[model samples]
Target: MTIEKTETINITSPLDIETVEKLHAGDRVLLSGVIYVARDAAHKRLVHALDQGEELPFDPKGQTLYYMGPSPAPPGRKIGSVGPTTSTRMDSYTPRLLAAGVRAMIGKGSRSAEVRESIKEYKAVYFVATGGAGALLHRTIKNVEPVAYEDLGAEAVLRLLVEDFPLIVANDIYGGDVFEQGRAEYRRGGN
Candidate 1:
């Protein structure tokens, strides 16, 4: 499919259902604004808190979660080598988060069938941050502060303020899956 010059979109965080519904798999996005960071350990804690009906550090509604575990900041930097983790690791907890009002997620790799269903059901979207591009990605991050699960170290939940954070829509509310389409195209030797 040929993309038009206006296909790329620039968006800010705390995306609502209407904005997420407008996105489609394979669309390029330049996202700015606040996003929450969490990985395996942090997800576990959040899910546990939800199960126990405890208050979470941040509201999930209209929020975006980046599946990442960043390395410690060196000296004067706001962060270190921050990159996306394999999204599948968080699959078990994703539906709960989506149900709790998380509207978007950033990570690498394909997600489970259940998660995709939840995305459609919740009118949410999933985005892919390029893997192995930590250094470049870090440059887009303007600030970072730990928000919860501090004892988890690199796995702690963090609030990040980013400007023009790059991403590709991997899954969209309309049920598009870029990973599947890309694989099919490659199998047919179609660029």
Candidate 2:
């Protein structure tokens, strides 16, 4: 099999539909701009608020949520080790978030088939950060502010300004899945 060169794209957050549409699974990206931090606990609260007709802390439209629970910042630091959490835990809440107009999600691991279908339906994308590169990833985060659910501590939602945050498009609006492709490639002895 022929290996194609991957183009690296620099993107700003609050990603527009047009920008998200252009991305495909396996594309490398450096995202710079605003993104929200959330994990499973936060997701549950967000969904619960929605269910009760309560206003969400942040608007979901055109937004990107990164699945992370960061450690406390050291002296004079914007953030600590802001690592991507395992995404599967948030799978149940994902489709609801997508329907609310979330444009992209950043995390690691494959999503459930239901979540993947929802992504395609909502024209959203899922991105994966290198699982063990939290320290490196933290460097890209220029600003961080707790936004909601502060009682949750590290699980509280945070607004983040990131510069050149690295990610790979693991699943895309067009139904591409990089993980499956990689596995297939390996099985065929192409990698």
Candidate 3:
């Protein structure tokens, strides 16, 4: 599918409202700096913590959470293949997390309506990483450290320092949605 004049942008994680608000759907980004990794199980624990009125393991404010469970690292590597998982799996808990101040999310696939609504309402953004490019993505990760829920192993929350990690802005705070836009364009083209 053709994206209309995709612009390459460089951004950092733990992004603030100002940074997130400026992104638009279909823009390509090279994300650097810090990001937190978590999958379904960790998401559940995080939401449960919120429900109990307990503090989250890490501050969600101005943060980006990557939905992935990395494989074991090979010798002489800081991390293993770290690719995105289907985003819909976290749809149920996304709004709550957004409300808690998460600024962005990185994963593959489209999100639910509620999640999209929350993205606009909370002034956040959603990014899509290249799915099957884990090894390439792994090369960008410079460091990794266990952050929380270590017992969950690969599913645990981990802090990663990445440089020029590639992604596309799929949903923006202004309600721009790349997936829907692409579909509409395809239909218009009689494909």
Per model, state how many residue pairs clash.
Answer: 0, 0, 0
- Candidate 3, pairs of clashing residues: none
Mind giving the per-residue lDDT tens digits that candidate 1 earns over 131-167? Answer: 9889888888999988998889989999999998888
Q: Supply the TM-score for candidate 3.
A: 0.94
Clashes of 3: 0
Local accuracy of candidate 3 as per-residue lDDT tens digits, 1-191:
13233557889988988888789999898899999999999999999999999999999998999999999998988889999999999999999999999989999999999999999999999999999889889888999989999999989999999988889999998889999999887775535
What's model 3's overall lDDT?
A: 0.92
The CA lDDT of each predicted structure is: 0.92, 0.92, 0.92
Query: Model 1, stretches more than 4 Å misplaced?
Result: 1-7, 189-191
Q: Candidate 3: minimum summed lDDT over ten consecutive residues — where?
A: 1-10
Tens digits of per-residue lDDT for model 2 on 115-187? 9999999999999998888888888899988899999999999999998888899999889999999988778
lDDT of 3 at 106: 97
Q: How close is candidate 2 to the true structure, as a TM-score?
A: 0.94
* CA lDDT, candidate 3, residue 51: 99
